[model samples]
Target: MTRIRLLTVAWLVLFPLAGLADYLEVRRETAVYKEPSKKSEKLVTVDPAERSPYLLKLASGAKTKGYYQVNLPGANEKGWIYQSYVRRYKGQHPGYVAYKRTFYKHWIDEDGDCQDTRQEVLIRDADAKVAYQDEDHCKVEASAWKDPYTGKTFTNPKDLDVDHVVPLKNAHESGAWTWSAERKKQYANYLQYEKHLLAVSASENRKKADKGPDRYMPPNAAYHCEYVRIWTKIKRDWELEMTEAEGEKVQQILENCN
Candidate 1:
């Protein structure tokens, strides 16, 4: 009877503490900062090669501007650092690699239409000022080529939407859930440059809503080459995962890109 009572008491005490630990981990893990320094004034910035109290790596870089940066929330005990340093640090540390381009680049804009499409949608969406709601003027869509899931092509901007090759949910499920809001936004707005986004059929876009890259690719066997490249780039750049089938498909496509 006494042992039973003691176990019950221990459970009560430990349960809340366990819950508290979980809450703290989730809170700390998910919160992303606008700029790394803004969130924690005491946070330190370091070189990728320098041995520090934290485990950090160079995640990405911006060569156009001379700023370097590194990734935080790393696996080791040196502790967390700022996000702004991801790129510069990466350049300094040759071993610290990051993503450079996507397979979408290969999908040539024969008409050089990506920039124009993006600008038009941006302007229209900005003018309306709401996203994903009925009031919004722009939509998220796939490419103009006929979607294999459903044969349709969209020429009209109003009829198309931008689709993330790797779904945002998949990204969130991957380590992205731990990223700052700014990083999430950056990832969401990725490929703002050129044919990275497409003006595709709206119904097809809906069918692919937040689904992973493998879920809805062009069915035409010929298009798979470009399709796999885009998928691989997105997953690798964002550090997302793939089901075995998806990974194999990507491998097959990458052979072609190489």
Candidate 2:
């Protein structure tokens, strides 16, 4: 709670990681501008490479609206980079444990309409209309959903599992283990972004459990780029760190994207 400030607006997802970072890491191809604005002269590029993440140290805690005052990696001098282009970084975080029956993890019904996040995704992703468990449509029973992971179609809701594109376990290891329970709850049931959660085959989700693109990807080769893109976007948006292997894999796919 001390590190986070909640905004009063709707869709207020605070992007700060629960843990404090000792250094700043470039998220993508970031330019070190001579000043805080883009119109300022570009000093150099700070991009992540196979073995390097392009770390920066703060010259001072000075603020400039939407930029960080940091020292360029080797030059050790003041430069400015956009806030969104860099992420706070610490070293390796071990994230391989399986999930537990946590208090907040039960399917969330944010709208108090009884159709929990799971049901909502089922309904939203349906190729056509969906049936419900009750007259009020509180629970989705069946829907025609096309599984992007396997590129297969399923009509029964039981055949699908709503998946977190960046799996919870992976998130915990990356930076979310420090997240407040409420934040974890929000992420577990988040529906703000369509690609954040997907309705894919149950078996496909199980088979690809707790692994990154470096270790596993959707069986549908056609889905590789989209999968990587979603994975990268989710990681960047959440300010989560990718493991070396994971980072390399994502970078490779992104470099080849057309």
- TM-scores of the candidates are 0.42, 0.66
Q: Show model 1 residue runs off by greater than 4 Å.
A: 1-153, 192-195, 252-258
At residue 213, give the lDDT of candidate 2: 89
- Model 1 poorest ten-residue lDDT run: 1-10
Question: Per-candidate RMSD vs. true structure?
Answer: 18.8, 10.0
User: How big is the positional error of residue 17 in model 2, measured in Å on the Cα after superposition?
Assistant: 16
- Model 2: per-residue lDDT, tens digit, 144-219? 8999999999998888999999988877756555455677788888888899999999999999888988899899
Identify the candidate with maximal lDDT. Answer: 2
The ten-residue window of minimal lDDT in model 2 covers 4-13
lDDT of 1 by residue, 1-258 (tens): 000001111100011110111111111112222233344332333322211111223333332233223322321111232333332221122222233234122223233544334444433333233333233334333223334334454434466555555656655543354444455556665555333355445666777776654466655566666666666555544434344455554555667764
Q: lDDT value for candidate 1?
A: 0.39
